[model samples]
Every structure is written in C-alpha cells, then in structure tokens.
Target: MSGKKEFGTTADGKQASLYTIRRGTCEADLTDFGASLVAFRTEDRDGRLTDVVLGYDDVRGYEEGDASMGGSVGRNANRIDGASFSLNGKTFCLDRNEGENNLHSGWNRYEKRIWKTEGVSADGTSITFSLYSPDGDQGFPGNLVISVTYSFPEEGALQLLWRAQADQDTVCNPTNHSYFNLNGQGSGTDICGHQVQIFAEQFIPVRKGGIPTGEQAEVEGTPFDFRAPKEIGADIERADEQLQLTGGYDHNYVLAEKQDRMRRAAVVFAPKTGLRMEVITDEPGLQFYTGNFLKKQKGKAGAVYDFRSGFAMETQYFPNAVNLPQFAQPVLRAGGAFESATVYRFSRVLP
Candidate 1:
C-alpha cells in the first residue's frame, strides 16, 4: 500500500502524524498539535544518520506547553513593545503574556494551537499544514489564512515555504521555532564542539528586557563575530556589554553579501556526529539564540537539556519591526500577501 499516508492518529490519540519529504534524505514528523514539528531526521558524511532537532514525543506536549521549539509561532512572531501598536488611525491591544510585551500574536499563537493537514504525497515526501485565524482572534484585524509546505528535494534539503493572506488590515510575521542539535536530540547539553559561521557583518544590540535598541552595531571585534567559523560557546560568557545586557547571545545578526535574491545565512556543524546544517533564507536578518534558558528541562528520552543544549538561527525581517519605523515593516495591509522562506539543509561533515 501507500507508504503510511504521513497523516494518521499518532501513538497518542491527538491526530498527530509523520511526514516525509523527498528533496534529500529528510523526514519531518509534524503534528496538528501546535502545528508542531515532532522530529526532523537526516544523515551525515559516513552515512550514519540521526534525528538532529529537539521535539516532543507526542501531541500532548505541544498542545499545552510553551517551549516553542520546532513549532509555528505567531501573527507576530517576535514581540511588540508595550503590547500595543497604532496602525493607520486605530490602536489595538494584545495579550500581555510576557510582561508588558505581546509576543507571538497572543493567545492564538500557532505554537500552542492545532492545525489541519492536507495533501500527503504517495511516497510521503510532501505535505501541507494550514490554519485559519478569524478577525480579531488575537486582537489583530482580518481573517488570516496561513499555510506552510514541507518538501525535500532529490539532494536532501528540508524547506519551509510560508504563505499568508488576510482579508482585513493586520500584522503578520510567522516563523518556526525549532531547536536544532546536529549531534542528535537527547544527546546532552552544551554545543561546545560545534563550529558555526554566519554571514552577518553587524548585529542588533538589545536592552535588559531583551528588546532591540534599534541600532545596528558592527559584529567584527566583539564576541558576536561569526563571519568565520567559531565555536558557539567560545566567547559566550565573556564580560562584553552586549553579552551582559541580554544575559547571553540572544541578538539579531544582520546578514550581508546578498546577490539580489536568496542568500546563505549561517552554517552549523557537530564535530562528534559529523552532522552539518546550513541555513539559507530570503530574509535580511537572522536571530541567533543560544538556548540560554533551557533550565534543566526534560526533553526526548528523559535527557536533561541544560543551558545551551540547542540553538536557533531564525531568519526574518527583524524583531519589534512594528515599533521600529526604519526597519523593514512586518505589516500586511488588507488584501496584501506575505511570503517568506527558510531552508535547513543537512549533511554529515567529517574530519
């Protein structure tokens, strides 16, 4: 019969399913719970393979939790300062889930809600997950319909294609928050042995509350430099001003060297497992968060993920773009369409 339609009742009775895409040697397990990514597996240089990202064992974790990893986030992915914004002539208030800031569109955050899946390919290599957001569901005007496609090509790459359209004027910026560990999930803490290089020449400095300061500071001399390969924890705990302000490396890096279209943003590698991950995106900025807040959380296989267990390089226009006029706007006016791309190409790198 067909190779297990990718969509079926998971081990748990919550309508979860596994999806396999055919671009490379990748298989993405997606669940309707939180529209979450349950597992993303790929191989390395020696043909030894492993699951290289952190995710829940079932649907229950996503439906009632907030770790946010490997799940879709928001009508507004990041944050809106003070939990309010004035657009056109009217001002709207959002759920103050995090202090005075409204994050991930509030209450109706995709990371915490279920979505309906559609169209599973014969061999189980392509699948689509979609959700509809009603007018003012999260205090944002417009009924928004969002869809994301997961596909793997002949060469082994996992691509995320994001699409959204709204009927009324509103703001929308959605992103997947997947915590990746090239050495494989349930491994251990500290990505100390992994080497990374990002194409960013500058970075956004943040405040004590983790909000951007609106200034694009150069990443050359500081610990933020990743233009060349460097260990993630090399200068992480150094007493630098930016590092001190945000408690760790949780800032936005401005990707450079664009060729007028999509470009390479960052590369990550795990020396022990021979696994390497390359991120390519159309967005101008990439947020590098070192998972500085893991706080001994129990993850897959009952493994305790300590601080810096996994990291994320989320490509986007920018955070708090709604508050910063100079930054690329995240506003999608009525009748406007929003499109974005993020690709995580995996391969095993050996010494």
Candidate 2:
C-alpha cells in the first residue's frame, strides 16, 4: 500500500499537497490541513489491510471540524481548571470552554490550525512533520518549533517523538489523538470484545468537567483495575459517581515506574483476531477515553461508529497539571528540551 493517493485541494481552493510514508503493510496519508492523517491503513490479523482510523474521506470534513481524528493535540492537551494559572509570580488567564476549565487550549487550539509538513525518511520507516508556533499565539508565551515523527518498523511500532524549543517559557504538552480499534474499522459496532491491561495501580479521579480532584486512589478491587486483561465494558456501566459524571471511562491512570517510562504502559489484545498491541511511553499518565462523545458517525465502508466503537488511550502528562502542583508538572523551561515518547507495538499472535 502507498500513501501517494490524492487528498484534495487546499482550504482556499488552491493547490493542495499530500504526503505519504509506507513500510511493508503499514501506510499513512497526511494532508496539510491541521496536519491531519487522512488515511492510516494497517494489516489486521487475517492479513487484511484496513483503514482502522476514523476519518472523513473528503478534506472538507476536516475543515468543517467534525472529529480531531489523527491530528497532534497541542500547546497543551487535556484540561486546565478555571482556565487560569500562576506562573513566574504572574497570573495568566486562558480561554475557558469547558465550564470553568480550559479544554485543549480553548479557542487557540493547534487542532484548528494547519501545520507545515515535510516528508523525511532518514531510515525509510519513519516520516517527520514539523511546525512552528508563534510567540503569543494561543495566549502562550513562546514561539515553539515542534516535530512529530510517525514510524512503523519491523516491531510494528508507531513511535511519536516530540522535540521542541520555546523562544519564551511556555507549556508544551503534546500528544497524538489517534483513536484505535484492533478489530479493524467498520468491521463491527464496538471494541467491547477487546481486552485491555493497564500498568497502573492508581488513577486520578476527575470532576464532572474532567478535572482532577487532586486525589490519586488505588485501582485495586475496583472496575478501574486493569492489572489483568479485562473487557472495557466490564465495569463501564457501574454506578460509580465519577464514571457517571464523565459518561464513561475518562480518567488518567497513574502508571507504574517501569511501564510509565522505558516500558509499555498498557497492552490490548483481541482474542478473536489474535491482534495484540502494547503501548510503551515515557509519559507519567495515560488517559482512557472510551469515545463517549462519538454519536453515531459514519466510518470506513459506510459503517456507523456508535459510542465506545473505538477508544483512545492517550499517553501524556496528567491533565489539569498546571492547576494541580501536587501532580506531575507540565511546565517547560526555556533552556530544557521537552521530550515525550509513546510506542504502540502491534503483533499477531498465532492461533
């Protein structure tokens, strides 16, 4: 498979560019708009290649803002309580959309802007996309230069490497918002059959608006326990107040020392298909969002995506970190480089 297929014209009805990177059976198509992934075709257990990612085939869908898709979330991913923070002894106010909380940089989100793209393959299995965020853009104090690398090697690992330098001090919490379904897109109605195991003994509980309550509790004997492989829907319908507040699983699980860095944070396996995926990241936390907001959208092959049809296990710094000094710090320094890596290794177990 190749990513050379035509995407579409530019947002202004002018010329458009398409970039592709292919290795073996893995191929991904990235268009200029929002630096989005138009197509990500990977092989399934039966050796069938499918576009497992949920996206709109037309460029207009991306311009119209239906889904975040495979775009890189930035400036800061997740929420920041009250849309305000105190840094350098000065108070900074941000655009608040989620009630009093700031969700994904509010009005100045990176998802809403186009990114400058360049196709680089020093080793042939990886392609890097780079963009520069101007100072004072998104109400942040920095002109940040960032790079995101997507690679698929023999290990079937998609390693996301972020390197950045701020012209001024700013917060850099970058993470890819790629939704996954190991059963393959359009193949079914839900990912409930897939089993998941997260390397987290405790998880940060969140309020109704998705902000942490500054309490990290153990997952033992609770539905949040994923130390062993369990169905995502096993405890999904529980009567827990936190679960009901978020509509589903939408909490950040605190990773163990090893799996939190230099190891896999979680592993998911589809017993029916033998497709196993392991997530390895340097980030301290992983957000488990069960697509609670996907309201019956059409996916590949005209298949409708119902709630929990797919899930996004995003690895990054804890949400609302700016407000909770007790949690891991999301702040970046002028001289220090901000780096976070997450790898998803996919392999087919023999029947």
Over the full model, what C-alpha lDDT does candidate 2 score relative to the true structure? Answer: 0.76
For every model shown, what is its TM-score relative to the native structure? 0.92, 0.92
Query: Candidate 1 on 1-351: residue-level lDDT in tens?
Result: 113333434344546664545545667777665666667777766776577778765555555446687888878877778888888888899998778888677776777666887676666666778999898888888899988877665456778888989988888778888888887888874786789999888988877667788888888899999999999889988999889876678787887422136788999988888888899888767888888877776666676777888888777767787788877777887888878778888877566
lDDT of 1: 0.76
Model 2 lDDT tens row, 187-301: 7758777899999899998877988899988899777899999998889899988889898888899974222346778999877667788888888889988888887776555
- In terms of lDDT, the poorest run of 10 residues in model 2 is 1-10
Choose the strongest candidate by TM-score.
2
Q: Residue 207 lDDT in model 2?
A: 77
Cα distance off (Å), candidate 2, residue 59: 2.5
The TM-score, computed over Cα atoms with residue i paired to residue i, of candidate 1 is 0.92
Each model's lDDT comes to: 0.76, 0.76
Locate the minimum summed-lDDT window of 10 residues in model 1.
Answer: 1-10
Q: How far is 140's C-alpha from truth in model 2 (Å)?
A: 1.3
Residue 179 in model 1: shift from native, Å?
Answer: 0.3
